[model samples]
Target: MATEWLGLHFLFGAFLIGAVLSRGAGEHLPRTATQETRQVTLILLLPAYFLLAGLRVDLSALDPSGFGELALVLVVAIAAKTASAFAAARLHRLGSRDLAVLATLMNTRGLTELIVLTVGVETGILDGNLYSMMVIMALVTTAMAGPVLSGLLRPAGGGEQPFSGETAAHDEPLPARHAREETG
Candidate 1:
């Protein structure tokens, strides 16, 4: 089981790394590929992955305690990520649109969270129901990001910065400007 999980992780990691390297190389393979092809490929891969995941779930020794722990972890994970996104947005002084984009990107778990839960189940670290909850948590949190950010960015009145001043971070000051102070 461990070896299978490791192999799966390695394959996923390799795919992600390959994507990053290819993107960095400015390869335009996707541009050449038709939109229909891209859509079909995604549609096919998603169901296959989800089906394999569902098949792997083991439901024999279900426990109730794990649910509480899973809930706590999910809450913490979502809160921490959301708070960090807001903090980073403040520090960077991002506009409403950019902050929303950053928050959305930061909240994205993609397949990574699912992969982690899958590995936990395969390794016997987490039971099936617990794993399912984690999967649900991932889905819910990932889905909420878009709507939450949109709501937060919606205007109430006159123009004001979307992000609060509380978390605003400033970079290093300009030494040249500081040194060349007014002589008057």
Candidate 2:
């Protein structure tokens, strides 16, 4: 909450609180705590946030110029986020397929971006047109993740299950970890 005094967004305050709590309660959190938290946050909270953000978007505000600006924003955002993630992931022993998946997934920037944009509109930092454009940009960029990942991961043969874990994900370690959890 103190972040507002520094002219920062309240999202920073919430994020800071979450990070501090997670760090403090790392050992104290029960086994299912993480799973339960994830389920609640993703299944329940995220959709509500998205809906609230969607309500404020005025489609009429997006004229030809706005559409052009939206296009440019999408290109810059997708390229920047994907390239940075790809470069960072290159340090690992992942293959091209896994790297593409990881990089694309990292570009999923919806909730936080929307929250900031919504606040910007409320605070008059963004006009109605810019808010609509930015909101659409946030949505479109995040929305591309699923189809893009499917395309990147899809086999040339167009199989139902595109790739196997041991191969596509290079997730050999997950199997071992799950096996340990099952018996223990």
Candidate with best TM-score: 2
In model 2, what is the error at residue 138, expressed in angstroms? Answer: 1.8
TM-score of each predicted structure versus truth: 0.58, 0.67
Per-residue C-alpha lDDT of model 1 across residues 1-184, encoded as one tens digit per residue: 4434676545557557667675435445556565666687689977888788767554344467766766786788777876788688756565445655676667788478777777678768977677776776777788887777666666687354454422123332223333444442
Best by lDDT: 2
The candidate 2 region of ten consecutive residues with least summed lDDT is: 161-170
- Write down the lDDT of every candidate, Cα atoms only: 0.65, 0.77
| Candidate 2 residue pairs in backbone clash | none
Clashes of 1: 1
TM-score of 1: 0.58
Query: 1-184 in candidate 2: lDDT tens per residue?
Result: 6988888878788889887785557667786997898899999998998788888888786778878888898888888888888786666545577678878887787877888898898778998887888888788878889899889877879865543323334556445645776999
